[model samples]
Target: MTAVHLADLLTLGARPAAGLLLSLTDRCPLACAHCSTDSTMASAQSPGGPFRALVSSFTPDCRPELILMSGGEPLLRPALVRELTASAATAGTGAALLTGMFFARGGGRLPPAVRRAVTGLAHLAASLDAEHEREVGRAEVFRALGAALDHVPHASLHLTAVPDAAGHAYLDGVIADVRRRFGTRVPMLVGAVRPTGRAARRVPVHPPAGRGATGRGATAPCEFAHWPVVDQGGTVYACTRQSLLRGGPAPAHLVLGHAARDTWRTLSERTLGDPLLRSVRTLGPVTTRERYGPPPAADGCATRPGTPDPCGSCLALDPATADATARQFATPGGRAVEHTVLALAAARPPHRLAAARGTLPRYADLVELGWTG
Candidate 1:
């Protein structure tokens, strides 16, 4: 079952930003201390009811370029993975899945169902890091990936570590090892452990520092808002920030709509065109906050010194403020700037997107690893 190269996706840059992040379940077998999705054996699992229905709604002309299935561990629901990938394939949409490799602890045998699910995939990205290494040995993961290379056309590594010296050293060694074994056959996306989900208890939230801001302290446009995330409960969000989508009633601004009630066409339209979302994507949350928000000093944001947390300001927006944002971006100059941002991003190599988003600055080059170009 040959599939598309992972580099192909990396090369897409956020241009059209036409991709979907569909979380299959919130249940994971591994207990990595740094797990972001906070997965556990007892975590909530989502059946593919709305998830399937949404994918089924895709038409060839309107479908996303790619559909990325993730999870607490997507492989746990192998049948659903197979079903959705098959559905996506019919629409000329590419599909990929990410996992922590729970089945590879010992001899690393791919379960029959998992093998079936992985067949015909565009790619499979396996997670490995200090915590994952402890939960599943490095040897086991390597062996499992070696086995996978035979069935999948493209495979890659999704690694996470503390963004410090020790973490860098660990990733360097693993990347070297993967190359020694696979000889550039696999690329890697190395990232810092996000302080969300379970890890939040131990690590505080901090977007990477040194990100630039404008003269008035507005932040870089939030590339995060460009994609839509479908959480386990079928709730769709402008981005996958766990805090943004938690529980009973979501803030109206962040909630795009539920997957059960909204089709992919509807979600895509809302995500790409919603006034608030457009502002978040074009000018970034912090900039939008300042350009249309209360004086920074009055909000206590200016008093903090340095650019305020981008997402924090974004989350603070009200309907009226969002409307103000809509009108701002609707202007000719604002629209030109927005078009320039998208054009510049699309014009550059995709690795730049990886760097801006959070792949360690040093390892971002590896994003295009093994590409013939």
Candidate 2:
């Protein structure tokens, strides 16, 4: 199998139905304060049978091109990683994983089982940050990552960057250290800590200042709506937002289908053919809501004082509004509009796509590292 690079993930992420995100488990041994999933050793962990069934259902013609497995700590079940990646490979799908490197705490050595899991992957990414360092030293994490680079065809770092001075310095130091050690061979994807799960209070997430429901760039297509995310219980969602993964049935529009029941072909068709989803992908939630749904409320979820959240508006969509949205997209004109928006979004460069997806705009270029194109 060909190595899958960070650039490959970012580029493919921009297209609809090009990839899948499987949250293997909600359990993690670490207690990082900024944990978005609020994961811990005691967290809920579903059995792995459904996950294996879903991947096995994928045929070469119907499978997603990439399978991104993540969790509180996916490597906690190293054997599952090896099994799922092997299944994906049979269907011609490349697989990647994101782990917290908890096993590296003692001496940065990979357990025999963990080493076997890493060897079969197309890409392996480790998370590092101030919060993570409090549990596992940076040196230990790096040493483990260095060993992983040898086994996996491609490896990268997932770093968290806060907006303050301390956060900025930490990011710079880490990037430099990683460059000195691994050079440009490893790429990095830097994103701000979102206010979700346990990080909700610890991290300050302010909406873009002066941006309302119809603010500047409000109509940009939502590329994230492309990849479907499967949570621990095999429930599939259209968006990868962590908050949606919270244990409950997703809103009608966001819910795709259960992996145990739905085949890749069924989920892929819903991802592409659903009118409401198509609208969200073409014109962002804000524009979609305002154009078809009821007039926007001044205050709602994800909305702060004088600021509006497109995602918030999307989630709060009423049944009447949702129906209206579907009706609008069922028309010939609406389908044409969607096609135009997708064409423009596809023309964007990978770095720009990364930035648009809410990563720190300046640091987004790191995703293109080592890419000849």
| Alpha-carbon local distance difference test for all models | 0.77, 0.81
List TM-score per model, in order.
Answer: 0.91, 0.93
Off by over 4 Å in 2: 208-219, 245-249, 299-303
Query: Candidate 1 on 1-373: residue-level lDDT in tens?
Result: 1365656666543744478889889999999998877789899986689899888888889888778889889999888999998898888888888999999988788778888888878889999998888899988898888887777888899888887788789988998898898888888888888766666676544443212211223477776676688888898887655544552355567788888889989998988788777877777777777788644444433334554666567676678877897887779987898888877866667577777777887888887788776
Top-scoring candidate (TM-score): 2
Candidate 2 lDDT at 257 equals 92
Candidate of highest lDDT: 2
Q: On residues 130-166, what C-alpha lDDT tens digit does candidate 2 reach at each position?
A: 9999999988998898888889988989899576788
The pairs that clash in candidate 2 are none
Worst 10 residues of 2 by lDDT: 207-216
* Whole-structure CA lDDT of model 1: 0.77
Report model 2's TM-score to 2 decimal places: 0.93
